[model samples]
Structure formats: C-alpha cells, structure tokens
Target: MNIKKHAVITTVIFALNAPVWAGEASFIAELASTTLPQQAPVVASISTSNTYFMTSAPFSANSSAAITHQPQPDPAITLPQLIEKDWWGALAEITVVLVIGELLYKTGEESMKEDFDYEIEGNTGRYFVDRIVTTESWKLDDNEVGMNWGHAYAGALYHQAFRNYNFNYYESMLGNFLTSGIWEVFAEYKEVVSINDQIVTTFGGSVLGESFFQLSEMLDTKEGWVPATFAGVFNPSKTLRGWFSDDTANRFDRQQSTDQFDIYTGALYSTKDTADISTTTMLLGVKASIDSVQGQYDALSATPSLVELDMELGISAEGIEDWQLSSSLFLGGYTQEVKPTTGSRESWGHNWFIGPSMGIEYSSLGQEDEEDFFAAINVIGLSAGGEWQNADFNISVRGDIFGDFSMVKPFASKDYQASGGQFWGTKSVLWEGGYAYGLGHTAKLTLKQATENCY
Candidate 1:
C-alpha cells in the first residue's frame, strides 16, 4: 500500500524468484537437448505440407520453417537454508560498528588537530600499549556530553546486532559490554582507555538496547504498515538485514509474542534542589517490562522474575541535558494472599522481591556550562522491595544499595577526577488506601558517601 510495504514485498518477491530464474534456464537447456531427435521429423512434415499446398506454383523456397516449442514448467530449486542464529553475521556486525566508529573518531580528531595547530601523535602501537599495559591512574577525558552519549548509543548498536540474530538477552548484554571494551581497548588507539565511556557504553547501552528491543517488538506486533516501518527503524540492524539479504523472505511471516512484554512511552517534568540552585528538567522516556508470569506459574519454579528497562532523554531550560538509562531484573519470592473480607477478593496479594540492578548516567551538555560532563555506572547492586495490595488499600516499601564508579570533571576543577565508593543505603515507602478514588503518599530517604582515589 505504501512505499515501504511495496519495497518489502518487492524484495521478497525478488528473493523467491531467484530459484525460478535458475529453474527456467535449466528447463530451456533440457528442451534444447530433446529437440535434436525431433528435428528431422519436424522438417519432413513441414516440407510435405509446403509441397501439398503449392503444387504448380513457382515459389522461391528460401523460407525456413520456424519451430515453436511451448515452454516447459520450471523445476523447483532448493533455496539456501536460513540459519536462525548466525554467529558470523553477528561478528560481522560488531566489526562494522567498531570500524565505522573508529574511522569517524579519527576523522574528527584529525580535523580538530589541524584547526587547533596541534600535532597528534601517530604512533598507534605505543598509544595502545601505554593505555593497556601501563598502570596509569584514572583521569577524566576531554570528551563532552555528546561524545559520551554517542559512545553509549554505539554500544547499543552492538547489542542490537546480536539481538537481530536471536541471541538471548544475557548474551546480547554480554556482546554490548564486550564490544564496548574492544572499542575502548583497541579501536581508538589515539585515546586513552576511558573509564567513563566504558561505563556508559556497557551499562547504559544495555538499558537503551533492551528498551528499544522491547519497543520494536511491540511495534512489530501491530497490524499496520506504519507500525511495521517504525519497528524496522527502531532496530536498524534488522532493517538492514531485511533490505539487503534473503533473511527477509525467511522471516516475512514471523510473529512475535506480545503477552509477556509491556511497553509504554510517556513524558515527565521534575525539579531538583541542590544548595541554592534549583533545576527543572523535562524528559521523554520509554519503559518496558517483561513479566515471567505470563508463560507459566509454578509453585516450585525458581523465584519469578521481572525485567524492567528504562531510557530517558532530558533537557533543562538552562541548556543542561543528558541521556539516562536503567535496567533491573527483579526476582521475587513466593507470593501470599490474604482475603480479609475485602471488597474485591481478586485484588489481595502480597509479594516480595530482591535483585541486582545496574545502570549508567551521563549528564551536562552545554559548552559553557559549569556542570561536569561525566559518566557514572552503578554496577550490579541489591534492590529489595515488598508490596501488599488489596481492593481498598496498597502499601509498598523498597530499598536499594549500590555503588558508582565515576569519571568526572568538576566545574571548579581544571582536570578530570575519578571516584568510586558504595552508595550505602536508599529507602522509599508508598501508602495509598481508597475504595472508589485512590490517594497515595510517598516518602524517601537516601544516604550516600564516596571517597577519592578509588580504583
């Protein structure tokens, strides 16, 4: 109906017609081989007909008899089998991302070096060795907010490559981390190993990649060309393969399961207060959650888990902005229900969960901004929560303990600083109890302290 759909259909048709073309060639060759035996008879019959039709006519018999043979049906050709999970394709995708990223970085560096009249060292081997082998202290790099965010997105591309090949979630996450590490260690030989970039690329990218994956899956399940096109755009790796390879024909009718995942897009505005300055930030975010309960619920099934992924892009009127991502796989213990003469018996349930959460954040974009353009990663950390819900009331409490390893260039400092320490304890509680119209109140407290020279 539309250009995109038409394009997709055309590509599929072309792929399927490849075998048809080959078969047609074979059929023509077979007809030529069989024509030799019948050639004499055909010629004799044509001569007899000509003689019988023109008995007394003086006809110049220079005309040749044309043989009209009906085309034979083409035989079927066995198309090349499509591998469901192509490891080589995944590796090729990773290579492309790394190569292109490095090339872009080198180009930008060269342009800047020429403009600033600074000579950049060309000894890539030495640079790599110095950064990889030497025990150098962590120092903040000069990369700005855009660069850090781009690195994270690059990592997401790597994740998507593996995901496009049907890799599992954990495998895709591992690919993201490994690809980022490879880029940091080898691809950008001119730059030092960036601690912040690694954190942002690996963890933040995982959040972004997983969120995009879910959203794309959701879009793909919709029954419209617009949604399908958006789905392809959301997952560029899949789009590329679909357009360029026969994989599209193989997966044309593939369906995605939508019962286990929920995707939502929304906007929020919030204000943060620190000392004497208050900053209001507006964000556009997408959140996706996968509930394991959708498949099957077994009493002995090792603690049911829920995976949540969130990605946000925020900006302030004062020109401060950043990209933030977070993902957590929460594993819950046994569920218990209490039917205490409730108005709605179906709403009573109690659940407790505890799991590790990891994420990365990069902030501060303006050139003249006093804030630091830093990356912070919270590694696998513990988060525990309990919720009790009923028809008329709901109560929940949550606590998180995590640590952040950060590379930051403070506003007042001339150089970058590296810091890492435990976040100690953070807690929150929510209480809401109403039958017809629900009203709720929340309270939170956080205590965190970090020390310098943490490697």
Candidate 2:
C-alpha cells in the first residue's frame, strides 16, 4: 500500500511539472543562446580557423601581446544544456518524497487497525456509544407515464443504529418543470428486542410543508421567500408481536398519551433491529409550542399570544415488504383564550386533528451495479410528494395545494402571503412553464474523484 501511494504521488507530481519543466528549459535555452554570447563566456574553445580570422583583422595591433593574446569564444553557457545537467535534481526530489510518504502510510495503517481491534476486543470499559450512523441508497425513474411533472429525488437514511435501540432522520427533494418540493426534515427513534425483532418503543417528528411555507412567507422580501415546517412522529414496532388481537394492531396507532396538548417532551425507550420488516413499534411522547402573532393594517394593529401542549401514544410499522406505511390519530388542546391586544380579530381556541399518511417506493434490484430506475409517492394530510429516477439524471416534482399554504415573502415591507386572496380577472395563467433554447436545454458537468480518502 505504501509503495502504491508513493507511486501515485509521484505520478501526480510529474504530471504537474512536465509542462513547466519543458517550457522553462526552452525559455532558458533561448536566453542562453541570445544573451550569453553578448556577455563574457565561462567556457568555450576557439578553433584555429576562428582564431586565425580574429588575428588577421585589419588595423589590428601587430605587437606580440596582441597577436598571442587569444580571445576564446566567450565561455559558452547555454541554458538548454543546463537543464539536462540538472535533470538529476528532479529525480532526487521525487525519491525523497516517495520515501517519506511510505513511512507515513505504514504508520497510519498500523494505528488504525490497532485502535479498531482494541475497541472490538473489549479493552475499553463497558459504556454505550451514542453515535449517529448513516447509510446511503438511491433510486431512479425515467419515462414515467401520465405524470405531468416527472422528476427524480434521492433519499438519505441517518439514525442511531444499535442493538435494542435506534433512531432515524430522513429528508428528500425533487424538482421538475411544473414544481419542486422538499420532504422538509424529520427524525424517529426506536427500541426493540434482538431475539424476536420486536420494536417496543419509538418517537419521531416531521415538519409540515404548509407550516414551513407559511413561516417563510412571513419573513420574505422583494427577492423571494422560503417555507416553514416542523413535524414529529412516534411509533413502537415490537410491542405487538405476540398477539393477533385488535389491541395489537391498534397499539401502533397514533393516540393521545394524556389529556395534555402541544408538549414537545417525553421519555422514550426501544429495542434493536430483530427482523427485516420492522413492524411492531410503539411511541409515547409530548408535543407543545407557544406563539405570538401581530397584525398590521392601514388603520388597525393588534398582537395576539397563545400557548399549547399535547401528549400522544403512537405505534407503526417502519419497514414492511420493501415498503413502509404508517398512520396516527392524535388529540390535543391549546390555550382557550389569551387576548394580548384589544381590537384584533383573533382568538385562541382548542382544536384536535388526526393525520394519516402512507408512502411507497420501488426500484429494480441489483440495478445500481450498472444503471437504475426508481419512483415513489407519499401523502399525509394536506401535502403530497412524488419522484422519478434514471441512470444519468434524476428529476422530481412535489406540490401541496391543500391546507394553509405558505407564500413568498421578500423584505419585511414586501411580502406575498399564500393565503392572500388575490385575483387576475378575465384570464387564466399556468402556475409553471418551461422552454429550451439550445440542444433541448442541456447542461454537462465533470466530476473529479479525490486521490485521498478523507472519510
């Protein structure tokens, strides 16, 4: 390995220096031939033919001192020949580099192996490591039929993976001609038994697109605006493995943990990965928040304040048959009435909502070795998402037209609320459009791989 590394380094150095060395040598040679002759020559022999001509010049001194004094061609110092004489310098430099690189590589490799081996052999004290591990998988979909906005999206899996305990954080994004969307961001945790592959506990949350969009619009300006979203989920996959009763199936359902509403704290425990399909999972957690809203109009202004708390019990099947589907029904309440300002048309009230969602994704097996294709769709409450993937590139489209959608907000003085009831009369307009100017509107890029593994 050390030798290979040295060779690679040497090759890189040579590649970088070849053109420079050649150009320098040529320049030096030209300067030597043209400039050196004008100056004193360090070394040159005058043949008898040139010497005789110099001595017979007209009006030349006839004294013995002048006749015997020989002017050797100014010592010839040609730069072109100097490079050849110094070629050994470059060789010596490369040799020294190779030697040092070999030593470092050997030392690093030994250190890495020794450390890993020592840890695995239980030399360290018995202590749990709460490290977040990540794995990557991708899918592609091409030539999808019937979809108006066909695009591709990539998904990432990050979580705390260990025996009897684990957690997850997921995100996705895709765009096409019609629209673009993101999965926002969410995290989930689980605990289960190792023997039966049973999930005993879980907790998670996700940010909703509508909420994200709305918040983004409130803080936008002339340029543009983003969205706002925050959501969470809870489930336990291992607790219902033993029974076929209705209680087991309902164990994973989303239900309020207590009468409290809108709380974001809770105690959670879970088991390890025991089976391929993580079906039996349970979650019990609290969700809560506080908010202040103010309104400004031409002649009226007022601010409103509110606070809320909620607790929920939920169960779900995280992974099933190359697919995952989950549902939850939660109930909660908010501050009944808090009037921060008198003359504002706002009220604080308690409301409960149950949201159910399902997602499905498909990709050809072993297709990654060569090329791959993939597609997926998901929906929860008033939001929806879909994607397509192919070998060369991926495109995706996501749009949510339900609930309170967020709008673009530029600077504080200039904002467009999605909830703004604006109308353009006498004509209809498309929400999105596209056109290609050259070669069907294509873009090409080149990627260079790192020579050293940094990760």
Model 2: what TM-score?
Answer: 0.15
lDDT of 2 by residue, 1-455 (tens): 02243442342343234334334433434444554353322222212211111111111122222112332231222222222223343234323433553465456555434212112234222211221111111111111111211111111110111100111011101111001111110010111111000000011112222112112222221132211122212111112221343432111101111111222323334333532222233445444322221111000000011112233443444321121122111111111111111222232211111112222222221111111223222221222222222222223333222111111111221122235523233111111111100101111122322221222
Cα lDDT of model 1 by residue, 384-431, tens digit: 666555445656676765555544544433222224322133110001
How large an RMSD does model 2 have?
A: 35.1
Best by lDDT: 1
10 residues in a row with least lDDT, candidate 1: 428-437
List candidate 1 stretches off by more than 4 Å.
Answer: 1-85, 111-140, 222-234, 242-287, 293-343, 362-375, 391-394, 407-455
- TM-scores, one per candidate: 0.53, 0.15
Worst 10 residues of 2 by lDDT: 295-304
